[model samples]
Target chain A: MSTKDNPSESGRRNFFKLAAAGSLGALMASTPLKKVLAQVQDPEKPATNIADALKIPKTETSMPGKFPGKVVKVFDAQSVVEDKPVKTAAYQMLSDAMLQLTGAATLSEAWLMFVQPHEKIGLKLNPIGGKLLSSSHEVVQSVIEQLLEAGIPKENIVLWDRREFQLHEAGFTADAYPGIAITGTEKKDADGSYYNKEGKLYSEEMIDKDWFYFADVDGEYDDYTLPYMVNAGKYSYFTKILTQDLDKIINIPILKNAGSSITLCLKNLGYGVITNTGRLHAKLWGDTSAEVCCFPPVRDKVVLNVVDGLRGCYQGGPGANPQYICNYNTLLVGTDAVAVDRIGYDIVLKKRIEEGIQQEDSPRGRQFMEYAAQLGLGEADIEKIDLVEVIK
Target chain B: MKNTLILFLFLFAGNCFAQQPFVLRDDVLPDITSVNTRLFDKDGLWGYINGGADLYLEYGFEQVTVFDIKAGGIDYKADVYRMASPEAAFGIFSISRFKCQESARITPDDCLTPYQYIAAKGNFYFSISNSSGSPEAQVHLLAIAGNLLEQIENLSIEKPSLFNYEMLGPHLSGLKYISGQLGMQNGFVRWEPLFQQSKNYTAWIMPVKQDGSIFYVALVDFSDSADMETFMQKNGLTASNGLNQVVGNKIYTLFIKQNNRLVLTEGVIPESLRDYLEKF
Candidate 1:
């Protein structure tokens, strides 16, 4: 190994000593930030001076971020519970979130700023985890009330997810609540295939053939051509529900750790919207899942993220393992999915670590976050994220 | 020692589903209301628990005996991971550390909390958590946990005798034991790479606090002396005289060999504190 490969203990001590002395700002400002950044980033390059070692590269986050400092708003009300008929706590939480997210003087104004009368809005509800740990009905009710107050007609609003069976199993049905269109692309039948009871195939008219983005992995499932793009054939086709069906989406994802680390806004869309996700996870924690959000269907379409932290799963989740679940009773909201997911990832990771689970990093979801950032989707770095915590 | 009940369950003649070889007894806690379990093997475990289930399975976890204990209108969740062997039980147990400032001795070779508990017994590594927390709740949990432990007949690995508590100092909360790496990016204010490498080889770590200051004292035993020397040289600390060689910036490191074990320690403590060590 080269002499530059191994830095001495004095070198490390000097770095800490500089930290203690609070010369970090002077050191960071002394040199051209980018040039000094390159040397410190290099594994093989040994530290020549304490200043060079001290330099940290400021993350070049995506500009014109929707939320200030790429922040996600997290609101928790200890009062939000399952037994209550009307969620008195959820209304407070939602109102506080809207007032902060849009910086409106009132909750109605915040909702109005986002929802115009012309656009048909979709409230994407994730009910996959079912009764124990899915999006709370009371939380959704708060969203509906806000949208109505904002001047959007009841007919213009729709609450939907992947399959109607899951939606129904999650306690959402069109007939159960009149005047609100609660629907799905297809109904999951007894055999677990997507089909409408009326005998229409879900893949037929529902999936927009022209608007799909393809990953084009090894074997050809469908007879489509010229389907290769971005990051070496990490191909996928976007859901028409996220693309053509709705003009905008208000994401309601449950907080849980997927087998691949975290299943927040990114995974909710990446896996929930795509047709062929099995091919992606086969890579064993790579950037494939991250690249899915880079597509416009999720990246541009999602206007709000309200993570259902009311009851969260630290382990054995995105499934109903009630043993690993806990009640956080908080809702995390932000415009940027990357920022929102990063915070959600930390919450779950901390719980896992406390439970004595060893993880190298949030390796699977983390890289995908960086890929999203690399594509100018949103800010993935934690330092740049401005977290807004609201206690209701 | 593995949980003997696991093999004992297989020997019985009854409805195979009714009695799992390894499960907590129903009447362990006086106030126990109900019980629930989540287990992982080759197939069902994949959709179970958090990210590190694979690590436990690799450490010989045949099943994770998760118990949901309901008592006094409060619920506590306990997980008894029955590893294939006692060695596997301890290896996986390395991932957990005492989260408090100092662990109150409620059980031998264990850490306790009314809200949470971690202990390694035979081939079973047990963890208990209750969102319902209080001194009374903790007392109930300990009683429930203690009795539950008594019911399990399994082989276990003792806490390493190598750790010299007096010399290591009293900041027991700062101590950690893991056969796995600490996820440092060169993590936590850029001490990542150093902690990442130094932690996995660690048998024990203690934060020696004095004069309102804390110095991290650690004992890492490497399998090979040559590798230990390489590790010392690579970190730019080549010990010149007994344990004082890597000293710098209020940080002290000692590299020693006791037989095949390469016991290394680095911290922000005085070098004279090395006199406190006693071999396993």
Candidate 2:
């Protein structure tokens, strides 16, 4: 339903009035008020025309579907090596495939178009998997190299995640690659509070001497109340900083069969956008991971998605639970995040079936692609999408 | 048999008569005099004063009485100031006797207990006692008081904890709820970042639901009308027409769809005495 028809607005107004009155009877009556507010603020929005939103041109092969875009599958290779030579071969093959899919003249040009040079690019890397199941070093380096070749200066490109110490543990050097700089948000601010220099900080204008302003709305409604809105002194602000400065974002998600579900581009963006990533699970509405994935802050900022499938964990993931890593030697790149994730879902299903695992039995096997598609994020159907491969 | 019955009846009657005649005593209670002072007192308390002694009382609740000696022809007014409750119970009264004179200097320290006096300094503090005096119970009470007491009440205590002092101000303001979204840009001061090229565009609407209300806030990054029109057409979402005004570098469009109804009210308070309601 559209936000205009939301029942929570009046309910919230009532709640505020009752709260201001300090009346117990009013508070008791406001129970439904709270529920209605939660429902209206359910995070999910209609992803209608996402392909058009990303400026994906209409093609003859594009079929009419319930969702906004289509998912295309390219190549699925098993038993690939992780060393430099093997990784280069895999990337070259993947890059060629992406070039063909995008209809660009060269791989570099396609990469440039996908990630515009003038815009400040935030490459959100999924590093929670540590060294073993994180975004492959080869994939990250290749993208960086491609951006550098496309004339995107090193300073404008920021390789970021939540923690810098974790990146160091995973063997990433502290070198500033001329044009591209790498850092995390755990550094100290001048005011003694921690600062996330690259991402969106809590607006300083909202902070009073003791109390801080936290709005679920755009700060326009008079029904505003400060319930969970903590006083600034009472709580330390831990902000997701990278989102603030960047004009555009390229999400590099490792293809892993998450214990919770598929950890694809949507999960990557959703988790990366919020300071408290763990709180998503605590939300009462079922499948908080999927719900939070649809938030405008993360969903709107994402310009492109590139899924690393060269070596994937098909069984357990989002941090190696072991018995899940499988070499799939694939790279799925697309502007449509939902479509890219849908294809990733198919790859996971294929691996699960090959290993004699029941797709319905696994948590990661749950059909989020369908739900995401219903939300207008992308197309789950393969018949409408045109897939082209260039392998050397 | 008749004699025995008569004797039984008499015993019963005598028992009933003994239960009678319980009367509330009507003796003249101590006349409590009101003084313009900042002390707390109730009934059943008296203050003693000596002649030619200096005394001062700030205003709240204080009592004064005069004692005269006929032989010496000397009259003196004894000032009694009601101190705060020793055990921290509300409405329980205590008093301190002060000798009255023409002019006297009184500080908060003289009227309040050392801990209470320091707490009155508008700072947050907690008391830690090393002695073997009900440590667990006292610690709990101190913690409760730390959370509950206002800044004015805290001025009476001495040596309040620094951490508690820092926490007090913010804790009182409470949490604020806000709702809004990011949507279409109407204009730009400079072509930078998201607006790199002449027609670069991006915008979003976050119709935030807060405190049982909905507020529509739009964040837009493009100034081109054509781009905005295309965006509106592509998304199947309508734009708030005529909201093209730009303030500074950012453009803001605000429209309130609903008002919050939750009102805070003191149910039992009398309307005439609303000014003193915060004190409660």
lDDT of 1 by residue, B148-244 (tens): 5775554445445544456553444444444433222101212333433453243454445587765555556666766566666667776543344
> For model 2, what is the error of residue B105's alpha carbon versus the real structure, in angstroms, after optimal superposition?
85
Tell me the spans in candidate 2 whose CA falls farther than 4 Å from its real position.
A1-79, A82-85, A176-179, A186-242, A282-297, A359-367, A382-392, B1-280
C-alpha lDDT of residue A123 in model 2 = 82
Instruction: List model 1's recovered fraction of native interface contacts, to 2 decimals.
Output: 0.00
**Weakest lDDT window of 10 consecutive positions for candidate 1 chain B:** B182-191
lDDT of each residue in A182-266, candidate 2, tens digit only: 6564332445333246543323322222111122222111111111121112222222343245655677888986532477887
Error of 2 at B267 (Å): 65
Q: Determine the backbone clash count of candidate 1.
A: 16
Tens-digit lDDT track of model 1 for A18-55 = 53564445545544444534432345432213232233
The 10-residue segment of model 2 chain A with minimum total lDDT is A219-228
TM-score of each: 0.61, 0.42
TM-score of predicted chain B versus true chain B for each candidate:
0.68, 0.15
